[model samples]
Structure formats: C-alpha cells, structure tokens
Target: MQVTIHEQLVDVVLFIGARRRAAEAKGRHEEVKLWRYVWLLDDFVRVTGQVYRFEDSLRRELSAERPSISTHLGDHEGTLAQPVMDLLLETLDETPEPEQKQHVRVLIALVNFLAETGQLDEADGFVVNRWDYAPVAIAHFSNPEEAQAWMKSVAEPPSPVRILIGDEYFQFWYMREDNTRGMYRDYPIEPDLEWLTARGIPPETPSFATRVEAEAWLKSHPAHPYTFVAIAGEHYFAVHHPWLKRHSLHHVASTLEAWEERKRLVELDTDQETEDPSEGAGE
Candidate 1:
C-alpha cells in the first residue's frame, strides 16, 4: 500500500529531511513519525498567530497516517531555527560548499509547494455575502499628510492586513509583529478601483474616534448607524454610514459603480463620433 501525501507539503518534507530521518531512523520501530516544517518569514508570523491550531493540524495529520506512532514539533520562534534562516546562517557560518549548494537546489521544492498551495497566485478572496458586493473601506486620514502618518504608524505588526486602492498604484505599507514590511493586496487599479469607491459614506457625526463613543452617539441620533467595524491596531474604528440602508448596502453600491464605469467606457469607445466637414482646419 502507498502512503498518501498532500502536494503542498511534499517539497517541505524533502528539504527539511525531518520526515525522511524519522522514516529511516525508525524503519524498524512502528511507533513514531517525524516532520520538519519550513516556514517563510511572513508565513511563520501569520501562522504563529494561530500557532496552537497549526501545530495541532500537523500532529493530527501525522497520527492519522501512522496510527501507531507519536509525532513532535519544534519550538523555533526566532529566526535562528527557521530553515531559510538557518540556510542563511549556515552560509554565513562556513557550511561546506557542497552542502550549501545542495540546500540551494532544494529551494526549488519550495516553489513547487507554493504553487500547489495556491500561494503563487495568492488565494481567491471573494465576497462574504456572495449576493452582495465585496468588502470596501474608505479609511479617512483627516489630512493628506495623515495618510502618510497612518501608513507609517501601522508600519510594524504581525500579519497586518492592508487595503490597496489598486495593484500597481500604491502598495499600502503594512508590517509584521517585528515591524517587517509587506503588501496586503495586488489587485488591478485604474478600472478595478471603482469597486471600492462608489457613493460616499460619511462618519456618524464624526464625534469620537472609538467605537464606544460612536455607539453612544447613535443612541440619540436614532437614525445614524454603523456600517463596519475595523479592528486593525490599538483602536477599533466604527465606520458609521448614515446613508446606507443596511450595513452592507455599500457593498452592492460599490460594485454597481465599477460595473457602470466599465460599461460607459466600452460604449464611448465603440460609438463612432460624427466628423465636422468644414471645421477641420479653418474653424
């Protein structure tokens, strides 16, 4: 009987040699299976947020296949223990030329793993409410300068999600826990950006910065309501869109705006413009 393996994990297993060693070292002992994980820095930080769950998933998978065996996980939080980090350090530490080349060759496996897991093209993030439009947030930066300030302020955090206007336009700066930088989205701009900017929604009275303050204001207004809550950093901003019929009304509105703009452009390009006969050069 052949053992089942997930394509995403194949390259990782090959490089780390943890799984290989376990199978070879205890070929005779039917009591344990071992696995070595190779995490990219960003992945390490993101997964670390849910570390307990990730660790459990791996252990569970190993146990299910080799039911009679126990599994193990390593505590390698800092960069020193990670494979790529170790590889870098090894190159710095005077690892043998042959072994170093071997490790470099093994990196091709990482590419295969990334492709299999859909990381190459990134995951398809669709609307939570499929019937409605996609999620959109217009983060106000008070002054234009504040845009720079806010972006700079949210510079470092673990897996900080970012909002990009378009793919090539502006890569909104975001950081990991250690303040490492990364881009959140890579969507197309020019045309696609209309999906996020449709009818505008203003803050509910714009009284306070926090959610609690907005909730208090809502009690007296009786009409103003919050559309979305952004729990990004130290503060959770409650965006109150008084014009929205429902909380998600903007989702559909935003989508319609993009569709309309694209359609209008198509019509303008296809229609033939009437030429003025005598007004060419002497008009």
Candidate 2:
C-alpha cells in the first residue's frame, strides 16, 4: 500500500534526526553539521520563517539567484517529487560534499536535479488554501479519479448565478429577498468568455443552472482557463474556487442597507480588500 506524502515526510525527518544523533555520538562534528544542514533545508522548503537566515547565507554562498519558495508546496499529487526524495534517501549517507566546504551543497544538488528535469515547480506535494495560499493537506489522493470522487462527495453545490464580465474584472449578481440585486465584484475566478460566446451566453442571457453543471460543462469543453461564481439564497458564500470547493462556504454578509456596515466589519476583521458592492448599491 502507498503512503501519503505527509507520512513520507515524517519518515524522512525521523531518519535525518536519527542520523544527526548518531553523528553527534560518534564525534563526527562535520557529519553532524551536514545532517543538520539537510534538516534545515527540509524546514526551509516547508516555511521561510527562521530558516530565512540560513537560506540567505546559503543563497549568498551559492552565488546564484533561486526562485523564492512559495509558502505552500506545489506538487499536489507528489508524482514527480516522491521519486526524487526516495532516491535522495537512498543516497544520503554516500552523498559527499566537495572540498569547498559548503554544507548546503546536497540540497543544491537536489535542486539542480529538479531544475534540469523541469520538475522544480512541482516540488511540493500538497493541497493549499486559496485565500491564504497555505498548505492544507499532503495530497487529496494518489489517483485523480479518487480525488475527484472525494471532492464530489463533500463539495458544496455551486450557487446558481449570473456572470457579468467587465473590462478589468467581473461580478457575480443574484436577486435578493427585496428583489434588489447583490453582487460580488472582481471574483478571483473568471468564466471562459470565449466558451460562453461560442454558446451565445452573454453576461445577461443563459445563466448557469447550477455551479456543478457549469463545472461539468466547462471541464468537458475547456475553452479557456476560467470558472464561475454565484450567490446563495441569503448569503454570499465563497465556493467554487480550487481548494475551497470541499471546505466550508466562507460566509460574506451583504445587504442593501447593511452593505456599508458589512463592509466596515469585514475591513476591521481582515486586511483583504472589500469585494462587496458600494453603499446604496442597487437602490
């Protein structure tokens, strides 16, 4: 049976820690430092805090510009990364530093291997929170079909909505209880406009029956790299975005009279720019 990437990571970290302890006991100070360097490299890839100083020193010594590590890992499926890590584990003891005396060379070699094989961007093996771009899971599943089935089981149905594609941004408009309109502006995801146009779906005509149906159609057709948004019965829930589909619908309160109040409250709660409509909107 296969293990999740998280489990593999636990195993690797434990192995490194044990090796460090062994080196310390044998008075192999140089080997201990090397193992500690590898340990810190692992930490650096996970997060940049505290490790930044070590990374900065390594960066200078390497005398090469490296891409900044994203807060979240990228190889969501771990298909490419698992092999490299497994090989690294196999060779950890035999891999030796050069006469130049750099402790981070082992990690540098791993990085170079990734870059050479067009696998650098796929270094991470986890899902992430879209809102915060933070890693949330090791992997949804090794298999795409399994992951999709899991997602479908828990995904909140996409709210019925109409899209208003604008010059620079778009809006998701829905009818309110008072028959007035409510909209979320500049939603992160964009609809496949060309696909819609081909099917004669204007910003006004041919609203999606359901978000799920829309996604199915889009997935089958895939005219462009875009998605849709909609409002729920009373609340504007943040759903449909990748990584957010299976999670709880983020509650966003917006009403005609309460628009400004909601905006104020939201601004106070988070530094994120308010996405609701202007005060007295749809009045």
Candidate 3:
C-alpha cells in the first residue's frame, strides 16, 4: 500500500506544473514565477537530492527572475517563499500515487546508472531535503552480511606479497603492506646486483616459506623500508634496504646504470684534479 519515493516525486512535479499552467492561463505573473521555482526545486530534489542553495552561482543565474516574483508577491515583508516551502514539505510528507508516471521512469533510469557504476552502496543515504523529507529508498541486498563484508574490504584491504621468477632462473620475493593484495606477474628475467642496488634492495637475503614471514622480517627493520630475498639455484641472497617498489625490474636496472655512469664521470673529474698538480700551482 506504500507509494515509492519516485511516485511521490512524479505527483509533486505534475502538481507544480499544473499550478504553473493555471497561473499562466489567469495572467498571474507572480504566481507563475512561484510555481516555476517550485517546479525547479522539485525536479532538483527528484534527481540529485542535493541542497538547493540560493547562493549557488548557477542556481542564482537560473532563478534570476525570482526577484521580480518576490517584489510582486510582496515578499519584502518575508511572508512568501518560506510559506511556499512549508507547503511543499507538508505535501511531500503525505505522498500520494502520482497521476503522471514519468518521474518514476526517470528515477528508474538514475537508479540503473548508479548500480551499473557500482555506487549504489547506500541508497537510503540519498535524502530529499535538509528538512523533513524521507530518504529516497533503501538499498536492497540479498545477503546484507556479505555486502557489509565487501564494504569493509573496500575500506581496508589486506597487504600483498609478490613472488616473481626471473628469466635467469632465480626466485625473487617482496612484500608491500597496504590495501593491494594477491600475486602479480611472473618476471622471467634475471635481476643483477646493479638492478638490486638501484631498487635499494640488499645484495644478501634470507629465505622464507611464506610472505607473512617476509613481512614480519621487513617490519622488524624500520631503518630499511624495503627488503627482498632472491634464490638462484642453491644460493640465497637476503638484503634489507630502501627501494621504490612500483618500478619494473628492467626500468630500475636502466635507472641505476645511468646513476652509476654519472657517478663515474664525477669521480673521473676528481681524479683529474688530483693528478694535475701544475694546473692549481699556476692559479
């Protein structure tokens, strides 16, 4: 027996539009403006349910004719707009079945868009007004507990530990503690010591059966932000140091090579200064 919010919105829209038409027929210019404002407010609520602020630049521009309506309706005494809004609130409180069903169709389309975009997490949170209108609708879920769990996961995700096997037939493992979880790609390429240095990973390391153990070890050393363990045949290398994890192994290798080249150039310059005693003596 309960009418939906969409039905109520449809009724309000039709009612306001009818009032506007009637005012137009009677040549009641002030009343026409009032009904037009009501129509705009009703449409805004039905669609977005956001507050209709008078000070909004776009809203102010759209409703620029309100001043003329206000002057004609003798709103200088402050008796016009508030009373109309109160009447609207009262009407919305007791929503009846809409004579026209267009608003219901609009509501359906909006709901479908929200659902398709995965934003329908809290349907009831969509309120009509800052005052007394009821929430638009309650989001229906088959398993509410499951839905809650999913929301929780979205809010705070578990950490991920990646195990990568390189082309040089070495196993490399790293753990990042954050929302990202699950294993990533298998990098079938060998990472040399220079690649490890560029990533700020230690040249030596220890082996762990699980990522949990590696995370614990990494966390224990706060000084070393990033740590990785690599196993090549019978040998294992464990290192604890700082590194940027988001870069690919190839990229890190190239970056480190460039850095090393710069360093060598600087060192060569320093060596040239030390070797040429005659240059400084003349100066």
Please report, in order, the local distance difference test score of every candidate based on alpha carbons: 0.34, 0.38, 0.38
Candidate 1 residue lDDT tens string, 1-283:
5322232334333544643364468672321221222333223323223222233344443333212211111232222223433443343245456543334333333323333333432211111122232232324233445555666665342222223231111234332324545443322332333432343433432445554554565455433222332222221223232222212112334444555776787688666354455555874
Evaluated at residue 52, the lDDT of candidate 2 is: 25
Give the per-residue lDDT of model 3 (tens digit) for 49-125: 22112112222322332211122223222323344444444433444654333332332333333333333332222
Residue pairs clashing in model 3 are: 166-189, 167-188, 167-189, 202-239, 204-238, 204-239, 205-237, 205-238, 205-239, 206-238
Ranking by lDDT: 2, 3, 1
Comparing 1 with 3 on lDDT, the higher-scoring candidate is 3
TM-score of each: 0.24, 0.24, 0.23
The alpha-carbon root-mean-square deviation between model 2 and the true structure, to one decimal in Å, is: 18.9
